[model samples]
Target: MSDSSTAAEQTYRVVRNDEEQFSIWWAGRALPDGWYPEGTEGSRDECLARIAEVWTDMRPLSLRRRMEEATAG
Candidate 1:
């Protein structure tokens, strides 16, 4: 196998937090507390791209909820 092919085959997983933030995690590693898989697995670049597409809101979930409550009240 070539070096490029090996690099391309490098595995990654997409994980999300309670705030809905997205991150790429190395495959074959245990997920940290408070993070869960987003059901995506691929190359590192691919996982990052998937995160970019889905994680549009940068705000944490609690902050967003507070903002919404304030606006509503």
Candidate 2:
């Protein structure tokens, strides 16, 4: 109902897992296992913007590596 509360609700952080997938997580909450912060924190839109900018490759890291290996051989 207040601007401050609304802003607080919008706060988020960018997180990534071992697979290198990008996602937004609520700030101040415990990150799930294997998920670590990607160091960008701000409103939901800001976090998502960062993800869009950096996560151009949608493939998971392991999958990409395997695909490269298969091609190289």
Candidate 3:
């Protein structure tokens, strides 16, 4: 309802899971299980930019490993 509240809502932190999947979570909130902070925090756009820069591999870690194994055999 207020400008400050809206700004707060827009703040986010980049996070990643065990599968190496990248996402954004609200700053100062409890992260979900299996997700850990990547030490970058900012507005939604900033967090997304960080994810874009780091998450070049869209595939999950397990999926990539499986693909590698399939090709190796």
Per-model TM values vs. the true structure: 0.85, 0.87, 0.85
lDDT per prediction?
0.91, 0.94, 0.94
At residue 36, give the lDDT of candidate 3: 99
Once fitted onto the true fold, the runs of candidate 2 whose alpha carbons sit more than 4 angstroms away are 2-9
Error of 2 at 70 (Å): 0.7
Model 1, 31-62: lDDT tens digits are 99999999999998989899899989899999
**Model 2 superposed RMSD (Cα):** 2.5
Q: Give one digit per residue, the lDDT tens place, for model 2 in 1-73.
A: 9988787677799999999999999899999999999999999889999999999999999999999999999
Q: Each prediction's Cα RMSD?
A: 2.3, 2.5, 2.3
Candidate 1 segments exceeding 4 Å error: 1-8
The digit string of per-residue lDDT tens for model 3 on 1-73 reads 9988797678799999999999999988999999999999998889999999999999999999999999999
